[model samples]
Structures are given as structure tokens and as C-alpha cells.
Target: MIRHRDIWRALDTLAERSGLSTSGLARKAGLDATAFNRSKRLTGDGTPRWPSTESLAKVLNATGVSMAEFVALMGEGNAQALGQRIPVIGYAQAGESGYFDDAGMPVGTGWDEVLFPAIGDPNAYALEITGDSMAPAYRDGTVIVVAPNQDIRRHDRVVAKTVEGEVMAKELNRRSARRVELVSINRDHDDRVLAPEELAWMARIVWASQ
Candidate 1:
């Protein structure tokens, strides 16, 4: 199956490795900032949004990752090639009350459905941005992939969930004895420091569209 979720996850990984958010990735690729945003993922009636070939090529070029590498990141390897199948849903509906469980796993309910060729791994999922706080780097409606199994390194862009129930995307700076520092990709955004106790979970960004 050509799962779209897998492609999204791969993009998230690439962003993290390059220290960029979805919007940052789009900027690096010379595309519109919202090219990868969640809002653009669907039409008002709900549809599977697709990226232009030119944009995809640009993203691949900016990341310096080959198509094979991207496919591998999505866990399909070269044994299978991407088809037209993709999973579709509204960005606003992705994080609805029942869409995710207490552990943040996809619960597969309350979603406005649409369909595309399956091109990604079933285990992979997408997250929709709900606010403009990450603007210039990520606009409202940008969909981000969280690859929990991917290795996280210093300077990587990450989606961090705090114990207080806050989810934020920022660049991982340094970890000291008791605190973690994160740098925002947007110049207007300030860096943040959090105590270890405030951290509940952190995942590396694998891929983003815009």
C-alpha cells in the first residue's frame, strides 16, 4: 500500500535532521510557506490533498535525501514503489477529542473521511497544526509527522509533549543537568527552557510538506 502517512512521516524525519519545521522545510525548498500546512490538506468538503511534483522535487533536493532514502525512511524500502493511494482527512479533525487516545495514538474515529492511494506505512500518522504561534516556520493547518522510533539528536526539530499537556515544535538545543533548551525556527519566536519534570514525551519530526 502506498500510504500517505508514511510519506508524511519521512518528511518529518527530514525536517528534524535538518533542524527545520514544516514551513521551514518549504522555505528551504523555495515553496510557499503553507505548502505543507494541514489546512491545505483538504478541501472544504474533505479530500485527499496532494503535493505538486515540482514541490516534492524541491523538497527532496533541499533535504539532499534521495528518493530511495525517503522511501526507506517510510519503512517501505525499495521493494515497493509509491503508488497513487493516500489517506485523507481534515486537519482540524485529526486531533479531535476521540482521534487520539491518552497516549496520543490514533483512535480512528470521528474523522471526516476521504481517500487516496495508500503509499505509506500504516503505523505512521499525521498531526494538524491548530494555531499560528509557529508561523513563518509552520502556519495554522500544517500537518506534521511524528516518528517516535526515529533517533533524536541535538539540534533536531522535535514535537515535544510536556507533562502539563502542552505540545510544541522546536529545535532541540542542549540538555543540561535539569533543563532542556529549545530554539524556535522563527526569528520572532523566543527560545524556551523547561524542567525535566515538565516533559512527558518528545518525538523527532520526520517530514513536512510546506
Candidate 2:
């Protein structure tokens, strides 16, 4: 049965999964912040007020969440509604070898994984890229999913680790005997060359939903 409560529940679940309140979700969707407020869910005469399709679509797009997943979230119990806990590590710490335990498990706290997308591989990790350093292509606050096992090729966007313990995302230009040539997506940023010894690890950018 299609009930107004179901729709409300779905929105609530989405808010929780995204770590945002109902009003926050609405604002993120470019809607009036009060659009999803509980008081706005009903009319003065007690008629159920449902969100417009446009509003719902906006929320889905903003959250990078698919419709199928949204529906599934709505159907789940409150405990399950909190979303799956995946390893959430900062972009700066991604290159640290021991940040993840020997078993490839994430260690420490300040990690909150929400339901954004299902990275099929258990070893897959995500890093929320900050700043416009790689912009004109990748904007600030873009979340990039890195697949360590994925093959990296020339000209591909990659997240590479340096022996100095720094991690940065740049387009792979070419690899030579002495160094690697990397291009910056944002022309404002200069390209870089790293000596062989400076490179520790590199992974191709599997997906970026920004």
C-alpha cells in the first residue's frame, strides 16, 4: 500500500544514512530547509502532504543514492536504517599503510560510513577529496572511490602514495626510468614528477560520484 508515511519514512531513512537531519537533507537537495520537516508532512485538515517528485529526485541526486537503495532503506528496521558501516578514513590518511590493520580492516575512530554506493569489493576504500587543487575536473569535497586491486594505466586518474607519506590524486601521464609524469586536471595546478624511490603505491580511480 502506498502510504504518505512510507514516503516520509524513506526521507527520514535517507537523512539518517547521509548523517544529516531532515532539514539538512532538504537544504542539500536545494529545497526549502523546512520542506522535510515533520510539521510540513500534514495539512491543517490532517491530509497527508507528500513531497513533490522534483524534490525527491533532487534529494536522490544530491545524496548520490539510487532509487532502489532508497526503497530498500525505507523497508528496513530502524537499526538497519542507520546504514552499513564501511571504513571511513580521511583523504590525508589514505596512504598510511597501517591505517588499516594487517587483515585490511580499518582501524581507529572518526570513521562513519553511510549508504552512498555499494563498493562490491570488501577491500575497496573511499576518500573524500578536499580543496580545488585538482579541480576544473574534480571539485572540492568530491568523494573518490579507490580500488587498490584495479589496474592503473597511463592517462588514468590515480591516487598515488609517496615514500614521504603523502597521497595525492593526479592524472597519470607517463612512466619512465627515473620518474613519473603526472598531469593536473586543473590547469591552475602545475604538473608534478616523482622519482621512482618517492613512489610507494598507486591505485586507479575506480569511481567518482561528484
Candidate 3:
């Protein structure tokens, strides 16, 4: 059953994913800035106060999130509707053994889990940036969600693994059956061109937590 806590948490999640604070979300919804504030979640007597239906609708519309998504966010537990629990590893550790298979799918062990928005790809994983090489575009500590099932398009940001166990995130300058060209966001880093034999696998970076 839906509860006050779940509803409030759902709002917080919605604001977070929308890149807004609760007040910011409220303001954007044309409501008072404190509408979804924690202090307003309870009355002066500390009793629960639910958000009005009108306010909820406004927030959903303001964020371009449907009612279904908002209700899913209020799920009781780790329901499929909540999101996917995908493997997460640091970019620095992606080159290590036992973390992935030749197909770029995560395998073996030593992987942590992070809840990511469902994008219909069970093989999706998250890579936490650990260096400045991918900065400005992907700063250190940012988490990038990789979708192996997604088609890699030219000029798309991608994460690739080399046959030599090297893993790097770069923009796909060009792609062909035999060779692919990569351009790094950092100017100090040299771009690369590799043949099929040199690249183990490459996947498009669908989303990132900056």
C-alpha cells in the first residue's frame, strides 16, 4: 500500500533525476517553493501530511514524468518498476581481470550494484570515472551507464575495451566493420584508431550521473 514516506521519497527521486532540488521542482511546477519541502511533509504536531493531488499532477507534468513513473518510484521495495540493479565498477578497475567477458558484458565477480533507470537492457552496467581524462564531458566520480545492446552511432560517446584489457571512454568519431576511430574529450589525451582485431567490444554510453 502507498504511504506518506513512499510518496515523499518518490518526489525526492523525481526531483533528483530531473536535476532539481525539491524547491526547484516545486517552483518549476508553478507551486510554492516549499510545497515539497521536508518541513512541510509533517504538521506542527508531527503528523503526516500528504501532498495534494493537484500538486502531484503539477510536479509530474513539470518534470515530463508520467503518473506511471511516479507511482513506480513509490514501489514497496526493489521492484522491477523501481529500476535495475546493475553492476558498477570504477573506470580504473574496468581493465582488471574477472570483471568482464570478451563481449564487454560484465562477468565473473567483484562487481558492486547500483540502481539505474531501466533502459530495457539487462546487460547495462555503470562505470565510475576515476581520472580527469574524460573530464568536462565526464568528470571524475561521475557514473556512466553503458548499454551494450544499444547500437553505437558515429559521434556518440562510448566506452570501449581493448583486446589488451585496456578500457577507455571516448567519442566515436567514426565506425566501420574493420576499424573505428575514437576521440577523447581531454585535449591532452591522444585520439585512437583501431581495427576490429584490436577492439574487444564497444558500447554506447546512454546516461550519466554527473
Candidate 4:
């Protein structure tokens, strides 16, 4: 799993490679000069505060750094490091408060954590499968890593949470300005098409611990 320090290390590396300082890098990315300052790396409570996806996107664009290369700059692997983890929760439990914020990013410390592979997105999380809704493709006990910042395209498997707190994993059969058509993995389950207003946020499924 990518740890907090890993992210900071990557940003610093990006600045060094660009012949600039952290503040300079942030400025080039159209962010405040102190955005990447060490003092701003943590919150008042000392908890780690990761760079937002929007900010990271800007930095990558400004530096011409591909997501793959940026992830590589995070240094060596830490999956073997005991207790180093990322947020995870059961599928049904996601509807409950405190697990996810309004943007569908994991928030609060109530979630269970597990070591997962690097996926480019700092806010990536895992969801344990719970029922037959996405069986065959993803049955009960399967743990899927979700990349909220990953690009979504046709035929990509995705996890979508609705405004009513309903979450479903489905294939992106088609997406348009007004409707999102999803194909269910289980033949027994009917395909679904949701209106733009029905979806709160939809993220791509990057990995499955099958």
C-alpha cells in the first residue's frame, strides 16, 4: 500500500526532477506556494492530510508526469510493512455515515484497513463484496480496490454510489450526458440505467483481491 510518506516523497521527487522547490512546483500547478510545504502535510490533530486529487492532477499536468511515472516516484514497496494500511469496508456498510465523504472519498477512521497495491490515486479504497448483485464477476468475499480518480470509459467495471447511499458495482455499458447504462455481472440481475441526478459519484474498479 502507498503510505502518506510515499506520496510526499513522490511530490518532492517531482519538484527535484523539474529543477524547482516544493513551493515552486505548487505554483506551477496553479496551487498556493505553501500547498506542498511540510507544515501543511498534516492536520492540527497530527493526522495525515493527503494532497487532493484535483491538486495532484494539476501537478501532473504541469510537470508532464504520467500517472505511472508519478507512482513509480513513490519509492519502493511497503506492503510488507506491518500495520501500514488503507481504508476498506463491506459493500452494504458503505451506505452508513463516516465511511465516505460527499465526493465519495473515504473519510473518518472508522473503516477497516488493508495493504493494497499502488494505484496512482491517493484516495483509493477497497470495498468487500457482500451479495449476489455482482456475482460471477465479483462474488461475496471478494475485495475490490476502487480508484476514485481513475478515468472511466465504456466497458470498464465501475463502482457507483447513488445520492440515496446505494452503491453498486457494474460494467459501464454506455454513458451519456443524461443517462448511465450499466451491465450487471450476474445474469440473474437486471441491467440498470441511472439518470445523471441519481448518481452521486462513480469510480473505476482498479483491482480485485480475488
User: Largest lDDT belongs to which candidate?
Assistant: 3
Q: Please provide, for model 3 over 1-210, each residue's C-alpha lDDT reduced to its tens digit, 9 standing for 90 to 100.
A: 456888899999999998999999999999999999999999999999999766876786678775547767876553455567788877877888777887888886557876654667899988989878887878887778899989888899899999898989999998878889999878789999999789888999887654
Q: Rank the candidates by TM-score, best first.
A: 3, 4, 2, 1
Query: 44-77 in candidate 2: lDDT tens per residue?
Result: 9999898875687679879988544775665655
- Alpha-carbon TM-score of each model against the true structure: 0.51, 0.56, 0.66, 0.60
Which regions of candidate 2 are displaced past 4 Å?
Answer: 1-85, 95-97, 100-110, 116-120
Tell me how candidate 3 scores on lDDT: 0.82
Model 2 worst lDDT window (10 residues): 77-86
| Residues 109-209, model 1: lDDT tens digits | 45433221233344345566767888776777665556555667999888776666566789999877799999987768788899977776666766564
Identify the runs in model 3 with alpha carbons over 4 angstroms from their true place. Answer: 1-23, 26-79
**Candidate 1's TM-score:** 0.51
Return the clash pairs for model 4, or none.
none
* Index of the highest-TM-score prediction: 3
What overall lDDT, based on C-alpha atoms, would model 2 receive against the true structure? 0.73
Candidate 4 on 110-180: residue-level lDDT in tens?
Answer: 67776544556888888989976687778787778898988999999999988888888889999999999
The alpha-carbon deviation from the true structure for residue 127 of candidate 2, after best TM-score superposition, in angstroms, is: 0.6
Poorest lDDT segment (10 consecutive residues) of candidate 1: 112-121
Question: Model 3, poorest ten-residue lDDT window?
Answer: 75-84
